[model samples]
Target: MRYRSSDEDSARWDGFPFREGDIIISTRSKSGTTWMQMICALLVFRSPDLPASLSELSPWVDWLIVPRDEVLARLEAQPHRRFIKTHTPLDGIPLDPRATYVVVARHPLDMAVSLFHHVDNLNRERMAELLGGPAPAAPSAPPRSIHDSLVTWINREVAPAEAMDSLPGVMWHLTDAWQRRHEPNVVLIHYADLVDDLNGEMRSLAAKLGIDVPEEQWPLLVDAAGFAQMRARAAQLAPDPVGILKDRNAFFHRGGSGAGRELLTDEEFTQYEKRAAQLAPNDLLAWLHR
Candidate 1:
């Protein structure tokens, strides 16, 4: 399926060259996309100090702001094992056996909370300029409170492919990946697991990706992938190559989870669980929310 938004078009994957051992970090916004990219970079390079910025090292291919030809050329010029990033789901992009698809799943509420801040952190005027459109006007009305926004986001109904960040959209992206979890080239990593055990997760992912890191360098690579560390280096790590983020450091706001669930009443939480059940299978929801 072709997935296109105002800012991205999955159809751009057409005629793209896929090299052996290419890694595609397919994830929804604020769902640990950059984190996985960092992990892949660390594993691929066997060092914490990358050759370039994270955004340059791993470009978002589907993003419309970057010219398709330029992005392709950049990827082509890279001599290292390419690890591309994308918000499009597994079903939306072509599945190449030679490439590994790493999909990160986060708790819906936590993802929603992070996304709320992410949208607020965006520089709309800069984005509009990058896309060759006129700058967007400042908001006339006050923005919705995070609590109110979370409630609305949970209840709003939309097709999964159409709104990949909505409740349904989150489920859609994960559901497709969950089904393909057993495939050799598809790997599923949970946000909570990474938070709970960064060291172990990084080691496990390295093993899965067939990367053999020397024992002496494990500590440095793992530390570099930590939330605090990433936030500290936000200028280099945050994915804002074109000055799209208002505050690059703000992009790493609240690396932990539960903020979204805290904003809801008991009834509201129950309602969210029920809505999630309707959208995704029982086992998938269990793993996702766990």
Candidate 2:
């Protein structure tokens, strides 16, 4: 399945060279893509002091703004274990047995809320200029409130590959990974778990990636992965290699959960649950909504 969007193209991964022990952070937008990249960086380097910016360390492989050849060259030049980032689903890209695929799942409602803010932060004019496309026209009406936008997002129907940020699209990405969860190279990590227990999650991720950190450095590494810590260093940590964001610090917007849930009525919430059930299996839904 090839995913083609204005900003990305999954076809770019067709000839990607995957080395042994390569880590691919497969996730949807606003679903811990940067967070997992940070975790992998911390674990791979075994230190909070990364050699380069987080975006430079783990480039988004499928993004159209960055030349595919350039992204490949950067990865090839890296000496350390490579951890690449992608918003494409599992089926969209080639699966190499030697490489580990880490899928990060966040609550759909929370993800939707984060995405709402994310869209606002993006500099569409800059993005258009980078992609060599016409500048987007100004909106005729006022932008929808988070509550209204999310309600529409939940009810909107879109083909998974066509709109990876929609409700169906989110489920499509996760369901594909959930089925492969038993595979040795596939690992599933929840955003809520990371938020609830950053240290434990970081340790578990390090163990899974076969990177051993010295006992003395555990506190430093885990603290570096914290939301507040990442926000404080937003200039380097936010995924803004180019000037696509109005404010890099805004990219690290409230990393907490339950904001989406708070905006809905009980009936609306139940409707969302029902819609999710239709799109994903019971076990996957349980894990996602939990």
lDDT of prediction 2: 0.94
What is the lDDT of every predicted structure here? 0.94, 0.94
lDDT, model 1, position 44: 93
TM-score of 2: 0.99
Q: What C-alpha lDDT, on a 0 to 100 scale, does residue 187 get in candidate 2?
A: 96
* Span of 10 residues, lowest total lDDT, candidate 2: 203-212
Candidate 1 per-residue C-alpha lDDT over 1-290 given as tens digits, one digit per residue, 9 for 90 to 100:
99988899999998879999999999999999999999899999998889999999999999999999999999999999999999999998999999999999999999999999999999898899899998888789998999999999999999987888999999999999999999999999999999999999999988888999999999999999999999999999999999999999999998898888899999999999999999999999988887
Give the distance in Å from residue 186's predicted Cα in candidate 2 to where it truly belongs.
Answer: 0.2
Clash list (residue pairs), candidate 2: none
